[model samples]
Target: MSEAVLETRDLNKNFGALQVSRNINFRLDAGARHALIGPNGAGKTTFVNLLTGVLSPTDGAVLLNGRDITHMRQDRRVKAGIARTFQINTLFAGLTVLENLYLAVSEHLGRAGAMFRPAGARREVVDEAMAALDGLRLADDAGKTIRELPYGRQRLVEIAIALALKPKVLLLDEPAAGVPSAESHLILDVIEALPEDIAVLIIEHDMDVVFRFAREITVLVQGGILASGPPDEIAANAEVRSVYLGEGTHD
Candidate 1:
């Protein structure tokens, strides 16, 4: 069988006396779209940190393509093909959409030698950035500063930035946290249409998008793995229903 692109075995974390993540086991194959979901305080964010090296796990291992990277630094993890998007949008506020993407592409390509050039003059870099923008349907806004775009479009650009990194694993924390329903749908479409080479692990509170996009769902409660499987199976599990879904509802 092909090796897992990313996996965590018995991963644990603590803050003072509080156990934020407890023996959480997760695995994602190449090209898998795995969704992590739970009610508030379920430790999903903590788990994302563990995988991305933002917060070191108090115990256990994180293996990327079968190599131990449990304690690697955050920047090292990004260099190792692990890229993430924050819940809040992060972008180059004063730069145009094309310029924002150009930086991302340049950062990944390690092209610091050309940083001084006018963004438009770097024909090859600009072309790649424009292509990425076009892929995300933001090509028309390429010339506009990020601040000029709507909240939703800015969010798309954030994902595009991560995509420019050419990650093998993409950890997204609440990609649609505060957008309007209509814009959220657009974000979902952008997410679903991501290139097949990247493995997407998303933490979302929106059950509608979770059920629609996830092929596999992992549920957490109080920092522990409560259940994980296909969405239909998890949605039907009695314990999950009682702990998360409340009484008498199959949603």
Candidate 2:
């Protein structure tokens, strides 16, 4: 197997006496389509936080391409090729879709200071932003403000922003959460169409999405991994079914 683009070594996290992640050794290889699923309070969010440098692990290390980045700052992590989207919408609600993506693209290029200039003046940034939107099939909505788009489209915009950063590892937190059933498929379609070279890890409660999008699934329960394998094995794992899937619990 190839070396993991991202990894955790005996990862652990705690809040005083409560342990949220324990000895969580994990890996995301290049071009991996993986899912991290668990019930509520299963430490899924905490684990992602630790990986993104949003929260520090009590004891352990985070590695990117075999280099230790356990204490790296969040923004630095992004520059180092790790980018993520949140469970909730984090876009500039009042900004047009193009504007929001432009900001991210510019920041990723270390040209954020040039954003004060007219959009046409920064042709490269705008082109890259447009490319991301076009890939997600959101180019038609570019002129609309995020607040004006439907909830589902808003989620797509968040993804577009993440892609504009040109990450090697893309961490998606509940990409379809709160989306109507009728529109959730749109998110799935986009996910399935992501760049083949970028390792994508999705944290989601929706079983259908999880099963369909993940080539490999890891079940996190009580701050630990209960199972990790292909989708068929995960679905058949009694422990995972009992603790998460079978219970029909939301994370």
Candidate 3:
């Protein structure tokens, strides 16, 4: 296989006596469409935290393009080509969608300090932000405040913000959470259309979405990997079904 864009080796995390991640040995290759799924308390969020440096592991290391980044700061990790969206919408409710995207694009360009200037004065920033929005077919909503958009569109804006950072790896935490079923397909469609060179990892509870978007699936049970393989293999695995899918568990 090609070198992984992101990797975790023997990763472990502990809160006193309770372990949240257990010797995780995982890899995300460039352009990988991977899903991490399991029941509640399976430590999916904690594992993402470890990768993004929101939480440090008790042992092991996180690597990006073969460089050790376990000790990297969270913001530093983002600057180093890893970007993520939370399970909850994190957009600035009062800001226009374009404005929110402008913040991210400018920050990525190291020009956030100058963003207070009129957008006309920062043409490049505005152009890039609009391009990001346009790529996601959200240009029409650019003038609307985040709160003015529907929840599903709000989630799409969150993704646009992440993409504005030009990340090599994008980690999406429950991108479709709270979206109406009728609109949830929009989320999957957008994900499926993401740039092929950007590795994507999604932590989701919807089985239909998982099966549709993931080329590979990893089942995390009680903070450790119970299974990792192609979607068909994972779908057919008895343990994964019994512990997660069959039980209709949500995380």
What is the C-alpha local distance difference test score of each model? Answer: 0.87, 0.92, 0.93
Residue ranges of candidate 2 with Cα displaced over 4 Å: 114-120, 249-251
Query: Which whole-number lDDT from 0 to 100 does residue 137 have in model 2?
Result: 89
lDDT of 3 by residue, 1-251 (tens): 87799999999999999999999999999899999999989999999999999999999999999999999999889999999998999889999999999889888988876646665477889899999999999999999999999999999999999999999999999999999998988888899999999999999998888998999899999999999999999999999888888888543
Best by lDDT: 3
TM-score of each: 0.91, 0.95, 0.95
Tens digit per residue, CA lDDT, model 1, 132-250 = 88888888999999999999889889898888787999998899987887788889998988888888999988778889999889988999989989899999999988888773255
Better of 1 and 2 by lDDT: 2
Angstrom error at residue 117, model 3: 5.0
What C-alpha lDDT, on a 0 to 100 scale, does residue 177 get in candidate 3? 97
Clashing pairs in 2: none
Error of 2 at 80 (Å): 1.0
Arranged by TM-score, best first: 3, 2, 1
How high a TM-score does candidate 2 get?
Answer: 0.95
Instruction: Give residue 104's lDDT in candidate 3 (0 to 100).
Output: 92
TM-score: model 1 vs. ground truth:
0.91
Clashes of 3: 0
